[model samples]
Target: MSNISKKNKGYFSEEIVKNYYINNGFKFIEQNFTVKGGELDLIFSKVGSLKFIEVKNIDGINDLFDYITKKKLNFLIKTINIYLYKFDITNIDYSLDVVFVKKNEIYEIYDNIGI
Candidate 1:
């Protein structure tokens, strides 16, 4: 796909993921959070824990292995930290998660992969 097509697809996938999360009882915090060269697709709270969610429009977990680069993970981690600091949010557990959407199905991985 072209760059523009890919970006629009990505944004649409994120919106789908966000809605799925919300329907499943997650509190939506923000979407398309950007800071400098870093960005996080979704930030949410669930069962007293804060979730930094990365949505991937992939078939499965294995498909994510090649997609989440180390550099991108570093950027995401730094951005989440900055967001926490900027908002003065503390005293709650946090985790990195991925919501993989394929067709009409949704699969979630909670702190399963390091990135």
Candidate 2:
């Protein structure tokens, strides 16, 4: 596939994951949140917990560790902190999550990621 096509596919995959989260009872708070060199794909709330989500269209999430390097993690952490500080949100527990979209299946990993 061409680069443009792949980019489009990735965007569609993220949209699908966003809808899935919404359908599954997560309140959509934000998307494609960026500050400086960092980007968090989605921010949401579920069961009273704040979620900082990263959406990926890859086949496996185990490889995510390789892709989201330390520098990127630092950036994302800084961004999330800035967001919380800017919004004065200190009551909710927050976690980093990953939504993986495959061909016909979606997988979610939560709370353990440092990103």
Candidate 3:
């Protein structure tokens, strides 16, 4: 696929994930949050807990677990730390979550693959 097509697919997947979270009662804080180190796909809050979510849209080529590499997780952690420090957020519960999108199916794994 071309770069444009890949970008569009990413945006579409993000939109779907955003809507799914909203429908499930999570309040949206930001999307496509970028820092100097890395980018976070979505940020949301629910019941006083903040969630830094990474949305992965799988095209059946690789397993979901394969996407959460050590380097990627480290980058994500750094990004989240930057976000928190930038916003002066302290003492609030937070977690890093991964949302896997497979067509119409969605699954979320929270605070497991990422710290």
Against the reference, the lDDT scores of all candidates come to 0.78, 0.77, 0.83
Which parts of model 2 have CA positions greater than 4 angstroms off? Answer: 2-4, 59-62, 107-111
Error of 2 at 8 (Å): 2.3
Estimated TM-score per prediction? 0.80, 0.79, 0.87
Per-residue accuracy of model 2 over 25-102 as CA lDDT, tens digit each = 999999888777778788889887888877677755576567667887788788889889888898788888766777
Q: Tens-digit lDDT track for model 3 on 1-115?
A: 5455767777888898889889989999999989787999999999988988898877684566788888999999999999999999998888888888766467544453557
Sliding window of 10 residues with minimal summed lDDT for model 1: 106-115
User: How badly does each model clash, as a count of residue pairs?
Assistant: 0, 0, 0
Per-residue error for 81 in candidate 2, Å, reads 0.4
lDDT of 1 by residue, 1-115 (tens): 3444667777878888888779989999999889998888999998888889888776445755576788878888898898899999898788887667665357655463453
When sorted by TM-score, best at the front, the candidate numbers are: 3, 1, 2
Clash pairs, candidate 2, are none
What's the residue-level lDDT of 70 in candidate 1? 84
